[model samples]
Target: MPRAVAPRVRRAPAAAPARPAPPARSRRRLAPRFFRWAVTLTVWGLVAGFVALIFFAWDLPRPEDALAATRRPAITMVAANGALLSTSGDLYGETVRLRDLPPHVPAAFVAIEDRRFRDHMGLDVIGMIRAAVANVTAGRVVQGGSTLTQQLAKNLFLTPERSLRRKVQEALLALWLEARFTKDELLTIYLNRVYLGAGTFGIDAAARLYFGVPARRLTPGQAAVLAGLPKAPSRYNPRVNPSAAVDRAIEVLGAMVETGVLPAAAAMAEAERIHFPPAPSRDAGWFADWVRDGIGDHAPPTSDLLLRTTLDARLQAAVELRLEAMLASQGRAAGVSQGAVVAIEAASGAVRAMAGGRDYRRSPFNRATQARRQPGSAFKPFVFLAAIEAGVRPDDGVADGPINLGGWTPGNGNWRSRGEITVEDAFAHSVNTAAVRLMQRAGGARKVGAVAQRLGLPGPFPRDASIALGTAEVTLLDLVTAYAPFANGGRRVAPFGIAEMRAEGRPIAWLPPGPTPVITADAAEAMRRMMAATVARGTGRAAAVSGLAVAGKTGTTQDNRDAWFIGIAGGLVMGIWLGNDDATPMEGVAGGGLPARLFRDILETHRGRGA
Candidate 1:
């Protein structure tokens, strides 16, 4: 206790000034200099990078050859005069030379898209400075500050990657563009490269695609619509986002008014008057898919391609409307269902009308071109055609009594047989047993298969007697094409879609006429006679065309899984199929019922429309 007391009393301290830990003044004094040094280093690094970028830009290649390398297939929409006849994007690229681009078009672009475009050396310093300040304050990259040349550079030489390296590449390409081309040339590249919506990539395509007019004829309002697209095409595309596009068009008009390109009152009036043109046929969805597949797979590689397809736009519209109405009548309570229809020009290979499915938005399988299902009784015509070709008279008698052949006794719908029926009567009543009997008598199944092959159907018909009962699978297109011979007096015609393809401004290729006959005129005539009898007094009676020479047959597969009506009236050969994708049987639907009714409605509508 004594030691602790002595320790507690003992400490005396020597004190100097309270320093405040050197007042933190040293660090404060050095920080500014250090920061300055850091800034200077950064500036120097940026300068060095800029110099390196300049070197890269100096050596960059020209835009013309690079663009040519892509050989982007020209815009290929099926159109008569820039009016889309269908909904799918089948266009290849079609470039118009810079000189061909309207002068006003470029002027409008410069006025709204860049404004100091001609004077700048691929960069606008003032605009850049403004963008920089704005971005700095906003804390994000907002304003692009891209000059026309920069835009051209990005479009021609760089991808849309968002990175420092991509920006560097874009800048380098822009400088290169400026060095290699004049302002006018760069402007042209920019005009051609810019994406104007509605599947249009250039001014020319946009003018033609959206307004159904040439760039030279674009009014101020249309020009504004084109100008407004570079911001965000999907948002401003008149075809895709019409309301937003109208708003953007108004904004563009305001910009035009401010720039003195358009009078204020004029801009306002035109903005109010601006209206989008009607879209191409909503029903040609199936046609477009068929066109795309036809070109991508079988079309020859060429600079310009013109595809002359067998599609009749008016007829297609009629088919679509009829199918839509039929579906509506069926109601949603019918559960999941789908349907397909196709029509061919009797004299030409042209497809008159086609319906791939009930709803393309829900499914793009295109049953007309892609689905392969049993033709059921629809296969009877081919068998009949083959029998006729094989010299079997339509009135020739075939016993319909049930016969056990190889343990498979195919019979009529009721598993019973109508004995000693003529071929014509048997086909008219859709007697399966009679068809099997005839098929067995006529070289088993090979005769039908041979006849199909001879008619230019895609290869390998099924090797079963049931094929005569339409048990073999076939695409609607193939079936239609094969039937075209009968309607066209036995001449086989290839089906096509594109009419012609052109380059920058010139035709590259024009589809010439298809090849000649595959079947004898005599055989085709006799077959037509037999098929005509089917519509006149057979299962295809519902599809009969009133006051028109119509020949056709109806098919119903097992369990009503597939129902089809293929027919020809005057110059049109149409095929309609009704079913589900999963092979589910439709409710009380038969080829002669719903499918035939839809066909008749479409035919009658087109007949009235005078197409």
Candidate 2:
């Protein structure tokens, strides 16, 4: 009883103080710790925002003139210097409206490449976040969640270099582009600029080159083939790798079905019937190369152009056929293995036919327009035309004897003199010594060079004694064009092939008529008559046409390294050359032999307008 009382008293005494029961202040202090944390976090956020502002303000690329050239849409017009080679790869890229695309094309692309395209505004936030997380987890960029708009933005204004700065720039440009253009407009620009396949730059070109059909005419199967090209055109080239391309196109067709772009049966049919015909592999590689060079000389290389050419399919085929036949017929006896043929309209600068070699696949020398080779007596026309202009006539007498040039002695091709002869006989016989004497009598080298220049020779024509021996190297194009004045009745119609050019249905440049008279009518007619005699009974006798009036000349360079037959018939000026690129001697070959025969065969075959 006593112990229980004592314990109760002691407990009551302790309870009396209660230790003041920890004050409310201590409990309240816990809130301050949380408040400090909140304040610290708030301060840090403000600091980060300020730094972001500074960076954004300082790191912007200034608006530049680099974009100035884009204000007016780039338009390119391509035309040939001679005949119509082709009118295929023409592009006047205006933004193609999404509505204009086969409808299913863009729909299929959206389904295959970007399903969330309709919901996004240039960027897919969820997709981006997911991709970023995945990249971080994988420690590499295994996924790219770029939307269609973003891809277009990068292609249009940014390079392929990868960096955080470029990524940021891409985002900025994408946002800006989205703000300025509608989905249709943006889609259209992308479609027009996107590379399709082959050497094509757009869906339109790819359609034509691969399918031999226009984009507007593309079927579902063909559309799928084109759609498959964006991933890797070269790797999945329908022309080079049809099986792979077909497999890839089937995937696109499947996407089309999934996206309701095509019915399932239609998609199946398209996938099953996915036929990709190989593109025509042109054997005229040299001709194509020459065409590129000619255009590049007058315009920049990157110029988006639709060139009109003067190439006649028929004439080109004829030239190629005749050349191959001639080379083959020569067997080993004709040691020459290279040749070129060029044909032009005498009244206009229209190039009708051009062949650079026997087979452009084997060689692309483009000897017709680019080769600088000795013309031999083929160049004598210019000298003779010049002499005629300087008061010498076809009937004018000149000594066909040994001629001496400044320490250089020139002899006839046969090393035999024809004594005194008419100017016509001198030209027809191609008497080198007499021609030298005539040049000396007709104001020497400078006058002959000037005459060649005036006649469109683009001469660096040699002004030495050997000039009469056709020592000056000249392009077949230049030589044929230089002879154009005589064929054109004394007017120099600068040789050209393109007829009319159009881009987006608008006329661009139409070739005007060429220069005025380079030689008097009398002189031209006299030279024409002389050259006609040459074809009729002289050196070019092998090139004579049965019914048509023809004028021509024959030439063979020193060591028989070159043989040339240049002439005009039925208003066409044609030049042909047979030679070796290595300057190897040709056996039993002369201008009047295989070259003249080939020329005559071509002329006879392709003489009429119907041809």
> Best-fitting candidate, measured by lDDT?
2
Q: Which parts of model 1 are misplaced by more than 4 Å?
A: 1-71, 79-104, 132-144, 164-182, 281-286, 295-308, 331-336, 389-392, 396-398, 414-419, 462-464, 498-523
TM-scores, one per candidate: 0.81, 0.74
Residue-wise lDDT of candidate 2 within 1-611, one digit each (tens)? 56555344433344444466668999899899999999999999999977875564355443243223252223332324332233334333344556566777676667656778767788899988988999999999866788877777666667777877677767777777788788777777767766666556666667666776656667888888877777778988887899888988888888888877889888888888777553332544555555555553343334444556666766667777778877877725678788889888887767777788777767766788878999988988878876777788888899988755567777676646757988888888788877887787778888888888888887687767677678788999888888888888788877654455444555556555666787788888898999998997789989988988888999998888899999998888999999888999898688988888889989767755357
Ten residues in sequence with the least summed lDDT for candidate 2: 71-80
Which digits, one per residue and each the tens of the lDDT, describe model 1 over residues 31-75? 999999999999999999889877656645566777765544543
Compare the candidates by TM-score and give the number of the best one: 1
Clashes of each: 24, 25
